[model samples]
Target chain A: MISIIIMNKTAADIFDEYLAAKGLRQTNQRRQILDAFISVKSHCTIADLYDVLKKKDPSIGFATVHRNLRLLCEAGLAQEIKIGSGKARFELTFGQSHHDHLICLKCGKFIEVFDMQIERLQEKLAEANDFLPRKHKLEIYGYCRQCR
Target chain B: MISIIIMNKTAADIFDEYLAAKGLRQTNQRRQILDAFISVKSHCTIADLYDVLKKKDPSIGFATVHRNLRLLCEAGLAQEIKIGSGKARFELTFGQSHHDHLICLKCGKFIEVFDMQIERLQEKLAEANDFLPRKHKLEIYGYCRQCR
Candidate 1:
């Protein structure tokens, strides 16, 4: 169990290493924003974030929260999702393991899912089109079980 | 070849059918806009569209163009692509079936590529999560061959 845990990388480790490579100082602001993201595990718009961060630390300005989120997105530490909503939401990005999103239109909830078959199919289709596919995001919009 | 072409759904035919279904008149402006889309072979922004449509018919209004485009999107005759570019682009939904996009950041050129593998994988993932996936769009950002 210890060996397995050691081999696995936590979201924090990935983010810290990314910052180190980019010569970006692990600032308290960044740490706070990152912690907020991990704690609020759902699609969160910038405005939603500003409101939440303001409650936790009144000293943190809206601009600070916004800037940190953008930085996280640019550094590949997070994903900006547009789930048919006008505003963009951010989520933590895990290495090569990427999953598609199932968005509930009614409740505005997002559920993550992964399918190997679809991934392989995309590769084959890309090959036929002479396209060197790199990264792809698949988001499906629908209602959840409770909503349905 | 003619018979086969008739058997398969043409883009314009699909557009006309959708328009009729929605009780939208096949107006000169709408026809012109649809023709402009069919004439071009790539993703287009509303500004890009206004440029083309204005040449064909100088009297067309931007509002009409915008309204018709929205109608087309709602009718499923066209697709609305939102890249991180801030402004959204529209493309006539072709009979080529559903596919993803490869957007060249440097040149601002976009290419459509189909990947069945990725689609299947997403479906499986959605099922596992008990999330009913409805639709998906993948936009990959990178430099194209020409731009590279």
Candidate 2:
């Protein structure tokens, strides 16, 4: 069992409160899965997370990971990323800042970048359209420098 | 069989040239599928298109529509939109100007908007990050007025 310390010292408490607010029970498996997810630096899909946890516990299933991911997003502990209209991937958001992605089409590489001007433009655009803009995702897919 | 005339009068010719370039045979089914796709005003998923075409031509199967969709994308007659990391939807791009979307999560509604400012901001951000932006998508997800 890896004692994964999160960026927020209250990560375990956050998870516990999330489960409590949702009237759900906290299990050993959920703690283990979040630990593994926080350990990885890049984005992860359910299959990727399953592979990581199964090696440690040998009992984690894909569906549990998938359900937990949705919960984590709802709890503001993680964020979902759109890598085209294909396989879904997520990043840990606890103690992490928000940014958009530049994904390489040829090599499946992701580079995270933050730009204040872009964020302002999005808010302005949403206001113009009468969109409440609870959440949004912006992804640029093309050949990265290495692939180019 | 709807004789769909698009912005480009020579759409079939374009398909023919694409097929020839790829060493693929231009078939009647491809033409019919293109006809159905071009006729729709909004975005369409494979199942959405199949349902639309199956009513017109029961002979067309799901796999055939799916395969031709890829060819249409490759041929540059269509553009794919990622509604989050969910199902793939496409729109006819020939002679249509570029735009982004505001999606209603509660009701599954898509509202397209064109903004010059958004486009300019994206180019600037990509340049700042040294990312050559080939293509980009921005989708704002929230409740529409009706759903709200």
Candidate 3:
């Protein structure tokens, strides 16, 4: 199993390189959005992000939040999850250590887990179909332990 | 590894039970819809379903297809996939044979793969977060083998 690690300096440097490759400007809004995202560690809707940005700086609009999110998603800085709900949620992308979500139906809690057995099965299935695997998102919806 | 096998009478029996559980009347329209769904052999939007139904039986209204699709989803007879697209496509739901999609950007071809590694990782993710796994969908957007 791959051990989970903190976002170290090397990761940050690589993130900068990713930004440059995407031709994205390292602007104040982008930094603020990323800060708010990291600080608020949970699945967040576009409106939720907008609300958080509003709390920090009153001038940020919903469009900005949506646009920055698309940028972040395009730059491989974040992942978007649609949990059969009304709106989609965005979270930062964690490379290598791939996991899926256990989403709380009521309180909207997200639990991330990593299992190697499932991963091997996925590869085998892909190969059987002659598919070239790329990125994938697996989200499981249910009540959390506390909720249950 | 769980081997893929023919979907036999047991599958249809289960689907029938699901229909009963959902209090849906097993009408000719329902049977025709199921047959049409199974015969299409591709991920389809409601519009696509309607078109197919129209070709076979012109009497079926668009609203009927929509309503039946909703019922099919409620009865767990079908799976709905939302790939950041405005509308949703659906396919018949099989058992725990996990799969992901390789979607074509141009032609909208959805190739399914059962990746055990991803499934296991998803389970571990849910376990780590104390989340009970209920349902999951993994869609990886990219060109298919032929498209690539």
Candidates arranged by DockQ, highest first: 2, 3, 1
DockQ score of each predicted structure, in the order shown: 0.44, 0.61, 0.48
lDDT score for residue B143 of model 3: 55
**Best candidate according to lDDT:** 2
Per-candidate TM vs. native? 0.77, 0.87, 0.74
lDDT for B23 in candidate 1 is: 82
User: lDDT per residue, candidate 1, A30-144, as tens digits?
Assistant: 8778778767755788888777778878899888888888888877778777655387788766443587778887887777776666767666665555556667776777668
Worst window of 10 by summed lDDT in candidate 3 chain A? A1-10
Rank the candidate models, highest lDDT first: 2, 1, 3
The collision pairs in model 2 are none
How does candidate 3 score on lDDT? Answer: 0.71
Measured by TM-score, how close is model 3 to the native structure? 0.74
**Which residue runs does candidate 3 get wrong by more than 4 Å?**
A1-26, A94-97, B1-32, B56-59, B94-108, B114-130, B138-143
True contacts kept of each: 0.55, 0.69, 0.76
